[model samples]
Target: MNRKRSRGKNPWRCSHRYPLRRRRRATPGRSRGDPAVDPEDPEQDPDDGNAPPSDDDEDDDEAGPVVTTTHRRFDYPPPVPRMPRETLEMLHYDQFWITYVGTRYRHPALPDDWDMTVEISIPDEFGSRQNIHVRHAPTRRNSHEAAISDAAREALTTLCHAHREDMAITSRRYYPCRSVERLDAWIANPEAEQNPRLESTIEYLATLNTDYNAALDELDMVRYENRKLRAWVAHGVEPAEEEPVEDPADAPRRKKARYNDPEARTYIRHHED
Candidate 1:
C-alpha cells in the first residue's frame, strides 16, 4: 500500500502549489568547491555570474598567431603604358629594314590632322645621319597605322629600286635577289594591296635589318685600329721618316755658260792657246 500522502510543503506531494520548471544541475564550467563571484564587484561581469577564472597565459598559448592581411589588386589591370610622341630611330642596313617600323607606340599629336609617326636615320661616313621623315593621315580603317604603313611602302619601294644596283654589289647573304625580285614583281603587279602575305613578308624580311648591325660595323673598325696599334707597340715598330728636300735657293750657282757670252768664249779659247 502507498504511504498516506503527507500534506507538507513538498512539490512532490503537492503539485498544485508549485509551478513546473527545469531542475538546475551542477555546471560543467564551474565546480561546487569554487567561490561564487559577487555581482557588485567591479572586476567581475554582472551577467557572467558562473564564469570560471582562466589564466591569461593558457588562453594565449591555445590561441593561434594573429595574422593581418594587406589586400592588393593583382586581378585589376594596370594603366596603359606611356608612348613617345615621336621617335628617331635608324632603319635598314639590311634588306626589308623598312619593316622594322610598327604601329605600336604611335602618338597622334594631331588626332584630326596628319602626323609624322616616326623618322628613320641612316648614318654616313662623316658621322652625319640622313633622316627620312614618314608622314601619315588617320583614316576610318585603322587611323594612322595603315597610312604610316602605306607611306613606308611608297618610300621603301623607291629606295629598294634605287638601291638595287648597290644591293647587287654588297653581300646580301640573308636577303636573296629572288626575294627582292618577287617583292618587286608583287609591287609592280599592284597585287600586294590585296594580299596580306606581302605585308607579312615585309615584316618577315625586316627582321634581318637593325641599327645594331651598323654599330657592329663601327665597333669592328675600332677594334681593327686598336689591333694595328697594339701590333705596332709590341713590335717596337716606328714609322719611317720622310727624306727632307734641299732648298733650290741653298744650292750653289751653276758656273757661267761660255756659249752664252762671246767674251767668255774668247777668253776660254785664249787660255787653251
Candidate 2:
C-alpha cells in the first residue's frame, strides 16, 4: 500500500526553499571578537600621527630598549703614542715664566709623517695653577721653533682676553702681561736679564718666607717651654719663689763681732737694727 502526504502544514515547509550561502566575514573567513566593519566609514591608517596609539604600541614604548651587543671579549688596538718631548725654550717676562715644550706625534690621518705640536706651559705659581699647561698648538708646516713662537703669542693673547673677561689670574700680587712686543724685544736681546721688579719681589718673598719659618721655630720653642713648665708644676718640681729679705731688728743677733775687742772676750753682740 502507498502512504499519502499530510496536507494541513508540511513539517519541512521552508527547509529546501532557498540555497544556503556562507556569510563573508569582515576579515575574510575570520570570526574573531572584532566587530564587523562598516563599509561606509572612512578608512583609518594606524601609522597616521593623528590616530591614537594602540594598547600594544603603548606597551612596546613602556618596555626598555633591547640590547643586541655581543658578549665575546675583543682585544682592542692600543692608542697612538707621542714621540720624545723636547724643551724648546724657557723665558721670564712681566713676572711670568713661560716654558715651551715641543712634541712629535704620528697622526692617524697622516700616518707616513710625524707632526709637531708645541705646548705652552706658564708657571703661574701664585695664580690658580701651579704649572699651567696654557696651550697645545699644532704647526701647519714643519718648523717647530716658529710654531713655538706663534703658539706663545697666541697663548698670551688668549690669556689676556681671559683675564679681561674674568680676571683669571688669581695669584696674590700678580698681573697679566699686556705687552708682547716688548717681551719679544727682551727675548731677542742676549744681555736681557730677568725683570728687575720680579727679582726684587721674589727676593722679598724669600726673605719673608725665611722670617716666617724663623718665627714658627721660635713659637715652637716657646710652646715647648710652656709644656715643660706645666709638667714641672704638676710634679711639684718647679723652683720655689724667692723669699723676701728679713729686717735686721727681727733677725737673731750674732756672737762674734762683740767678742773681737782686744782681749778676745766671750760676749754676745746685740743687733741694734
Q: Estimate each model's TM-score.
A: 0.21, 0.20
Clashes of each: 0, 1
- What would the per-residue lDDT of candidate 2 be over residues 209-268, giving only the tens digit for each residue? 334323433543554454346435444243233244243211111111111233222111
Candidate 1 segments whose C-alpha is farther than 4 A from its true place: 1-111, 125-128, 132-142, 166-273
- Residue range 69-140, candidate 1, lDDT tens digits: 111110112121001111111123531111112222111111211121223334456854444423221111
Structure candidate 1, residue pairs in collision = none
In model 2, where do residues sit more than 4 Å from their true spots?
A: 1-96, 105-129, 165-273
